[model samples]
Target: MKTTLTSLVAALVLAGCASVGTVDPAQLPQAPAAYKAQSANGAAALTASWWQPFADPVLDDLVARAMAANTSVQAAANRLAQARAALGGAEASRLPQVGLAAGAGRSSTPGQPVPQPATQYNAGLSLAYELDLGGRLLHERNAAALDVLSREQLLADARLLVQANVARGYLALRALDAEREIVRGTVAAYGETLSLTEKRARAGDVADLDLARVRAELAANEAEALALDRRRLELETALAVLLGEPASNFRLAPTAWATALPAVPAGLPSELLQRRPDLAAARSQLQAAQARVGVAQAAWWPSLSLTAQGGGVSNELSNLLRSGAGTWGVGLLAALPIFDGGRREAGVNTAKAQLDGSAIAFREQFLLALKDVEDQLGALTLLQQQGEANARAVSAASQALKLSDTRYRNGLVSQLELLDARRSELANKRAALQVRSAQYQATVGLIRALGGGWSSDAGVKLAGV
Candidate 1:
């Protein structure tokens, strides 16, 4: 019997060794060494606190609130907690289960040489453990662990998303504020023109047609300002939602758009794979799927378990632990499904299908990450050129407006010429502002694409990874 047991143990070990499922070491897609777009010179590393570089105090406060209270972020955290709990359960399953039990019963004999009431009491400790001969339990435990790591990465990704959104929204709002100021200045100038035109008409020094034109321009500028006001309200309310507050209760006082843009160097493309939490989560999920395949395949083999019980039994509770009342037993159990009508085969096939799906999804995510970085880098480079051109346009228009204003005051130019110059200046300035806003937004996009500047890749992993 001892020799048989030794041989069975050796068989179990060999079965376990042979049960490994195929999961290649993370052969994630490689990237070109350098980004295709022009890299920013002297760019600093992106950090977890990506928005802090903007140096906007209001933005800092808003991001802190969003991180703490945003519904999506909170939900992600809850999911992470659940994953950890599942991991704990899986880990516990790998260890022996021990429990204490106590029971009491009374019985009466009906017919015999003598009939009497009898009482029995028993107390004992019981233990059971799976030898994991087929490695099913081991794979289950590993799958759970990988799930936990995946959840952790998802949580980080959620935080990154929230911060990126807040930065973009706040920057856009400030740009709107800046644009509204420009419109307000234009309206003031138009009002002055209207008043002067009226006075000149009263003195019969200007035609009534010119006076009407001035009044029309003032009204048009006022309408533009009103339109900006409405747009600003929409943006403000949207931002309020991001902050996880009621729109009616949250307010951001208009401030100057002086937030500094951070320099973002397009690092090596492969580095993006390590830094992105979403990609990391995808990799973990793929690994977990591979583990599940192992678990499914394990079902084709036999399972071995050990169980033991130790206790004392006596007619009375006081004698339950008496020397002669001791009771003990142990069992070695093995089970192999004789037939399941192709159930095991179906399960293995299903798991492999899922593994295949996970691999494809991971590849898609990898491709998207690359696309995101390229899109933003190209945007930033192009936006810089646009900004430069718009700036020159604004400067030229301002100079033209000044010349027109002097000519009109000396009666060398008509009021029409002066009005045209002012219109040109206003249009150029607003265009410049739009380009600036794009630059800020694209910079934030690039930072998000780069995975909020994460550096660590430490976490739970599957075997042979």
Candidate 2:
């Protein structure tokens, strides 16, 4: 009987290794060797501070402030803290629990001993520990720890999003500033042409219709400048929100758009699984779900626990500590679910479903990450080509405007012709600014898609603000 009991205990100990679910990174979908839209190869890996490549100090400052103060970022940080606390709680559960108890009471016997009253005092220390016979506690702790990891990755993702938003906003603002200047320059040129036409009309060298046309063009140019101003204000206010400041107190002075576009290396598709925080978070969540399945499976097995209590009781408080009044007890308890009407089976099924869902979610995340990189790469490539064409168009339009102005002054062309040339030049210039702005935006997007930079060692770091 002794040998049989020992064998039974050993088998129960081995059963603790059983798990209901498993996750294999290798089982995940594989990535392609190269992105279809990639135009370059063998570039350096992105840095953790991806925005620094823009070479704009102001943009760098804005990104830092957003990461530090953005509401979403703060919320993620709080969640990470909560997950850490939960893991701590789960770990603490695996250790023995000890408690102290003390009480004093008075009681009276109603039907015996002449209705005498009695006083009692007692103090005791109690201990209890679950034996983890089927690895339930271990699986629970593992799940909690994975939850903490998931939250940490989510926080990193939040920071990456904030940084990308700041960069985009700043780039748009700069582009609008450039467009505003172009409109203002066009308005001034039209004003000069209108003045020249007025002088010619007074000298009877030009018709009233010509003067009217120049005046109309001048008014339209001024209106366009005004519209640009309104758009600039709107973008400024939006940026203020991104920076976590009141719009009334925040302002960005107009500056030249000199931001550099950083080249992003299109690494292997597998690298994305490691670099992207969202992917990492998804992976952790899947692991946590698998661990929970183990927990559920363990519920079908018996739970074993140990308990002990030592105490002393006496009628006198002073004698409570006496050895003669002492009492001690110890116990080993095992509980097996005798009847729960399929509750345990239901729990197992639920856990299995959750695990399946998590695996699907992880695959979806991976696919989306791949799509994100591809989209950004395609945009950057197209935008670069468009920018080159726009630059050429701007140069040609500028030359045409200069020639038309000379012809109008020499009385060889109508004021309307000169006005058309000026408008064309301004439109081309604004279009060029827009193309450049889009390049910057796409650069930021690609960086974001690549997981907000790379590290040589342990993937991206979440420490830098």
Cα lDDT listed for each candidate: 0.83, 0.83
Runs in model 1 lying further than 4 Å from the true structure: 1-28, 205-208, 266-270, 454-465
Kindly state the number of residue pairs that clash in model 2.
0
Clash count for each candidate, listed in order shown: 0, 0
TM-scores for every predicted model: 0.90, 0.90
- 1-465 in candidate 1: lDDT tens per residue? 999767765654554355455655465565557677856555666455778888889999999999878999999999999999998998898899999999999988898778788999999999999887667888999999999988998998898899889888999999999999999999999888888778878989899999988888889999999999999999889888888999999889998788998875544444554557888888889889989998987876787789999999999889998888999999999986645787877888898899888888877887898888889889988998899999999999999999998888778999999999999999999999999999999988877887874233322222224
Q: Which ten residues in a row have the lowest lDDT in candidate 2?
A: 456-465
| Candidate 2 Cα RMSD after full superposition onto the native fold (Å) | 4.1
